[model samples]
Each structure stands twice: as structure tokens, then as C-alpha cells.
Target: MNADRTKYLNRRALMGAAAASLGLAAVPALAQDNSTEMDAPSTGPVHNNTSSFRMLDWRPYFSDTRNGAILVDTTSRALHFWSEDQSIYKLYPTSVPLTEDLTRRGRTEVVQKVVGPTWRPTPAMKERNPEWPDFVPAGPENPLGTHALYLSWTYYRIHGTHDTRKIGRRSSNGCVGLYNEHIAVLFGLTKVGTQVLLV
Candidate 1:
């Protein structure tokens, strides 16, 4: 009877180890798929629990892929970019605005691209947070992370964030946020005239 018990325990231990290894392997896959981990910019409660990381065609959104096209789906919490010739298609999980009041949808273009972009609180942001510093130079401490693509709209940008927790969630003040590394890749792919649509 003691030998039988030892055999059962050994089997259980092996099974448990297998399950643990499988679970560990899934962690990276979840991040890669842009699953429920997507967060948008804001301070409000997270009403949206999951992101819809679907690949969409540019035809439905843009009339033409002039100078490349970018589509930001606030509902899905995803950003899709198509290269000018449609040779490269990239999808990235993004952090959107915390609230609809802070969200802006519609057409815009990348007016500037900055590496190590500086950050300054908008008038509205300053009014809301009186204690926030007037300016933050380009660095790790800056909210704009390592790269930024300034849009046509004032005080709005699509940029990188050092805060990994912000990715795959709704955590931005107004601008869309991406992981620092992901934004670096996007920064290289996109140019100043790239067309952008937020919906």
C-alpha cells in the first residue's frame, strides 16, 4: 500500500509540473496577441475588460493609403498601421483616453516626429492637476517616453510611455499611448505626413 501511494504521488507531481510549464509559456503569448492586457489613457474605472485585436483592411476606413494610413479604434483599444504601398501592416495594443470627454475622434495627420520628445501638460491638464510640473524634458521621466508623433490637434499626440502598466488599458490623459519599444518601431515606420484616423 505504501508503494502504491508513492507511485500516485509521483504521477501527480509530474502532471503538476507539466501544467505549470504550459501556463508559463502562455504568458508571452498573451502579451503578443494583445489580449485583455490593452489599456487606454485615463483615470476612470475600466469598463472595457478586453481588447478586440482584429486585423482590419484599410479600405473600410481610408479612401486611399496616401502616405500610409493609421487607424486607431478606441473601442477595440488597438492601433493599426498600413504602409504606403500596403507592404507592411502592423497592429499594436494601445492605451486610450480614460473617458469619452477626453477622447477625440476623426481625422488627423502626423505633423512632427520627435525622438526623445519633451512633455508639457496642456492648459486643461494643468488646471486639473495643479501640482504637475510645467515641463518635462525628454528622458525616462517624460511621459512621452522615447518617441512621439505629434498630431495636428493641439495637445494631442500618439507617443510611447515608460509605464508598461498603461499599455493594454485606458490610462492616458488625452493622447494615445503605446509601449516604449513598440512606439520606437512605429516611429521608424511612420513619417511626418502619415494620415491618422481615430475612432
Candidate 2:
């Protein structure tokens, strides 16, 4: 293997170990294959923007203790933001990685929240697809969309995606992908250190 590839693998392994040690609540593992190849980000301009998913009553899915928690239901491809009383929740459709393991479940905190985040393909990603750019400046064309919520102590993120078509499907490299508009609203509601539970 190339030196760059070797380095990337090593770093990925270390990150995996760290996540496993973070004491995230373990959910029942899935055994079925869920691999779905992702197409390259669209270069064309986006138009007629609309979301296929709806904002619905989410009280049944939230807990009183987890008020303001970001609960991501990967199986349903949905994200729920709980209200102060856990009496209401706002729902948004999201895209997750095809491999269930790629979606880090359990618990993590929002370490950083950025508006218009730049896109940087990981070394491992670049190795697999040499056409991937090393860095993409923050903009409409960027895959990270308009806002990003970086999870603490891991490489995962709940971020916006330029490709709205991918929402409500298994189509990301590993991060949770949302529509640009949906993420913008979510970004405003979220704060640093907010708890996120992926299930």
C-alpha cells in the first residue's frame, strides 16, 4: 500500500478504538447488508428546493431526561429535536451511511458548530477516490452544505448536504446528511455541547 493510504488506515483504526471506548450506549447491531454507493456531489446549480420528509409529532420518541437532545433514527432516516418538556419535537429527514456500523450510535456531544464549513476529504476517502479534492472551500457547491455540527472526540458530524436527493436514504460516507434548509434551522436550534444520540 502507498504511504498515504497506510497512514490513513492507522489513523482510522485509532479513531475507531477511541469511539468504542467512549461508552456509547450500544444498540442492537444489524446484520443485513446496507451498502449503497454514493455518486459524486453535483456540480450543477440547485433549484426547486423542497424536502420529501415532513415535520411531525415526535413526543413518543423522546424522553423527559433528554430534553433538547438530538435523536437520530437511522432506521427511519429521520432526526428529532426534543422540546423543553419533551412534549414536542421537530422532525427532519436525513441521510446516513449505507453500512449500519458507519453510523456511530450511542452518545456524543456537539463540539463545534460552523456556518458554511469547508469540505476536506479524508486521506482514506481520497485514496479510494483519487478525484476527491483535498479541500473544498465553503460554498453552495460544497458537499458539507451550509452548516455543520461536529461531534466531540470523533470524526462524525451532523451536517448539511448539497445533494438534497440523498436525504431519507443511506448515502453518506459516514456522517449524517441533511437538506441545506433543514440543517440551517437545526443549526440555529443547536448549541455547542448539546447531546446527540444516534440510533
- How high is the CA lDDT of each candidate model? 0.79, 0.68
Model 2 lDDT per residue over 26-123, tens place:
31132011111122363333222233333434445444434367878777787877555555446777887756555568878788999988877766
Lowest summed lDDT across 10 adjacent residues in model 1 is found at 33-42
For model 2, state the Cα shift of residue 53 in Å.
Answer: 7.3
**lDDT of model 2 at position 183:** 83
RMSD of each: 7.6, 19.4
> Model 1 compared with the native: what TM-score?
0.78
Off by over 4 Å in 2: 1-67, 85-88
User: Could you tell me the C-alpha RMSD of candidate 1 in Å?
Assistant: 7.6
| Worst ten in a row by lDDT for model 2 | 28-37
Residues 17-133 of candidate 1: C-alpha lDDT, one tens digit per residue: 896775543333423523200122344465554456667889999999998999999998899998999987888888888888888999999999989887778777777777777
